[model samples]
Target: RVKETATHKAGAYATVTVPAGSTATYTVTVSSGGTSATGSGSYTAGTTINIYAGSRSGYTFTGWTSSDVTITNASSKNASFTMPAKNVTVTANWSYSSGGGGSSTNATLSDTKVEFDKNEVDDLKVTLKSGSYNLRSIKNGSYTLREGKDYTISGKTVTIKASYLDSLKEGKHSLTFDMSGGTDPVLTIIVSDTTKTDPQEEKPSVEDPVNFEDVKSSDWFYDAVNYIYKAGLMVGTSDTTFSPYTDTIRGMIVAILHRLEGSPKADIANGFTDVGSDKYYTKAVAWASENRIVSGYGNDIFGAEDSITREQLAAILMNYAQYKGYDVSMRADLSKFADGESISPWAKDAISWANAEGLIQGSGSQLMPTGNAQRSQVAAILQRFIETITK
Candidate 1:
């Protein structure tokens, strides 16, 4: 409290009062595998407060948990939120990957069946067994559910979004869970209606046709490019040109794989001297490096801008498959290719695995291991990779 005194010429006094502003407190914590940035502090309401989760070696950051506060990117290791009028606590979740000196185990989710009213907005949770696993996809007959938009997973709980439930028809539907480990679980969802109502026909959604001038319908990579574009994995260099012949850079490939994982946040700086700090591929490169997807040139260099060769792409993709806990034991007899003997020793296993998986095919009698890969070739390889795993 403060007090003021004033005297005028006629010995009269007037007083003005002022009050101190209020502030909100914020606290951040990490469950494991990382450390939170020093975000515990008091700030004025509506102030933008930054939070960070610095991941330790061998641990992967999952997501953030905050009840009342709305984080800008809850899944990012580095995120921000506005300070509310009251105190808030944010916790970051992290997990250990197999490569991080952790033993692997076969895990599965418990099959669950639930019935609810069509107007109900409660989320459904599925129990996950003890193990580190990733949700590959959710399938309902021929329809696939999109993560984040349709559902979200945190730790052992898989929450079926209320919006997704409300969108379903009043009938029994089975959602098959495609997990990375053990047996896949099935979720039986039965939406019921309390009152009789006429069934409304859902309008079919029309997909825009791919119209890249450089990618003609007769081109060998036409379907691959179309798949890549539709999957939201790649885009054209221009509005009308796919630039199919352009050389794909190392950074671009890393960025594509990052997108395939929904672009999980990696706030830590990747120790690549060649990779720029503010480039568009910075976060993607960091995430890839942390996941052991790409190991660049020695001496702390990633060569993000350099064009990636066939062998390099194979090696990177192989590492990625292994990280995803996919079966990468398949090997092809490279002796069939004439120049197979010329393939680099370090990438031999990767090249063999890629060939066996039909992700990379040779032309005529040459494997072209050292040749720089074109955008079209990469698109084809990625399409084949996706098909092989989804099956």
Candidate 2:
């Protein structure tokens, strides 16, 4: 039996080394001056050490602590102590396990400390901008933005620098910036085409024929009917009859004008009481009346749905010609027409103007001044109107 030592004084000290990949167990005995106390410990090679002090019947055991040492096992069982990589001070403490049993032992372990080195940075700021537009602002870190992949702020320009971007794929790209903050203006960039054509003209499609059996076969009305139908400017009643000979109403004429000039600008005046804002032809009629293209019958009442006469159609064509900036004031006299008196006082000047512009011509020697204007006549007038505008 090994002689027991006193707990009040240093008990027994021993140092043992186990080979790598192996383990060993040892017994540490505590003595209370003359009495011996029991304890056991186990250690593994390579990186760890376990110290255990066996239970003493009247006394309890406390664990170990060091700056570098980590306790792997619970502190409740045997007091386990882990050895540090470098030499340092450590402590193992204990007191009485029973109410008045009393206790003692162990001070700091000596020489255990370690050292190492590395690099770090502080206070870094990153910004992104494009052509007077600021994108993002970042601070306090190393910012590694890709050339083209990462965009940045530089003064007024949100620059997508060329370094990381592919030159082959380089072209103007439109960027829409959210300007809600009022800090930057929204920007759009077009890379390739600067001019875009009208969508309607881009794809040319054939026009549908205005279904008038008699006039569809007529050479004079063919171009007019085709042009209006193709542009979706006109459509026949049903699939068969255009009712070309039926007189066009004043409202219908206005509808045609609304379609023809692609619905030109119009303003409503306070004088017209019958014209309501919600009416379908209100704007069209207002435009025609204001521009002197069409007017009322009597007492300022525009007969909007009344059939239009040849003289009325002539006046409309003349006003349209004048609106197109054509000079047509000389051809007022229809001396060859037998019923020249039948021409309305309000229509004479416009009729003369249309005749002077060569937009209106008599069938043979007849001026047809009082004749009701047909749908074919209206189509012819529209065709001439289109030609005038194109020129």
Candidate 3:
């Protein structure tokens, strides 16, 4: 409390009052992405506050935000900071899961069913659309084909052992490919008589179309696959296979984007602890990260090898486009999709822009926003994104 006294000349005196106690207080408000036990609070000047974020299934907490001060642990679930002398607003952040975002499959075999005409010196070789396609098991009836003993697998080629081939009966037999994490259709093998001796037809030279033996020119993603390969933004799983149905990992996509940027020298520090210095994508990750084109999971982990989803890719591309001076504003409404709500809140704007710009399409009425992205889809989207920007 304060009091003031005034004297007018020597005879008259007046009393006055003055306000006191002017300590500043601040309000701390939390935002979206996850729920907080304490939504908001009030604190006196220079008061320290501890804030922790809750975890959501299939989402990772990327930290908090405040207008007044830099968040101490922006990427961790638990964080704390001192309150400033003004109203402070902080928000929770999360990244979507890329492991299971879509229903799309991987590149399949050109000949889902293979036939053997000769067995004496000929090996039953199967070619996959993607060299990296996972082969869980090959089953003939109840007997599983031993990987090294019965056959050998390398890159896109799967070879049947000469010993196994010789022991096979000369009747119609079937082999089934059991694999995971791909959209590849069912592939089968038929072993017929192996005595016919005839010269095989000439193979297509490398100068031919980008079509691998497995990818027909008539396939939906043929053009997109070819465009990316020719543009050097992407390539086949091997010299001849594109693995169109293969899941594209976070690291691989960033590398592709980096290439599209003409492999510019970013000279940015590698902030992610997961990306090793000896990794092929280390420089690319550093560049994309430095340019604000990509983000890692909380705790400084990028999950580089983890599969990325369509919406995730959309968000990433949106960031890259904006960095390149492209307009990524919300031009399209996404309420039409059945799973529109499945789109992560942080990715809503980017997905909206991609959808509005016609850079990405949905499955009938479903956007499958949380589904994993296939390599073929990446190629197609990358082509569309590049065209949109260049045009």
Using lDDT as the measure, the top candidate is 1
Q: Estimate each model's TM-score.
A: 0.50, 0.43, 0.48
Clashes of 1: 0
The ten-residue window of minimal lDDT in model 3 covers 199-208
Winner by lDDT between candidate 3 and candidate 2: 3
Residue 374 CA error for candidate 2 (Å)? Answer: 0.7
User: Which regions of candidate 1 deviate over 4 angstroms?
Assistant: 1-208
State the lDDT at 49 in candidate 2. 40
lDDT of 2: 0.51
Stretches off by above 4 angstroms in model 3 are 1-208
- lDDT by residue for model 2 (80-169), tens: 344433443334445543433643221111111211111111111222233222234321112223323334544443453332222111
Q: What lDDT does model 3 reach?
A: 0.70
Tens-digit lDDT string for candidate 3 (254-306): 98888866776766678899999887688899998876788887789999999
Across residues 123-216, which tens digit of lDDT does each residue of candidate 1 receive?
8888766466666888775456767866798877888877667656566768878777756778788877675555441211114658998888
258 in model 2: Cα distance from truth in Å? 2.2
Candidate topping TM-score: 1
Candidate 2 Cα errors over 4 Å, as ranges: 1-215, 218-220, 269-279, 330-333
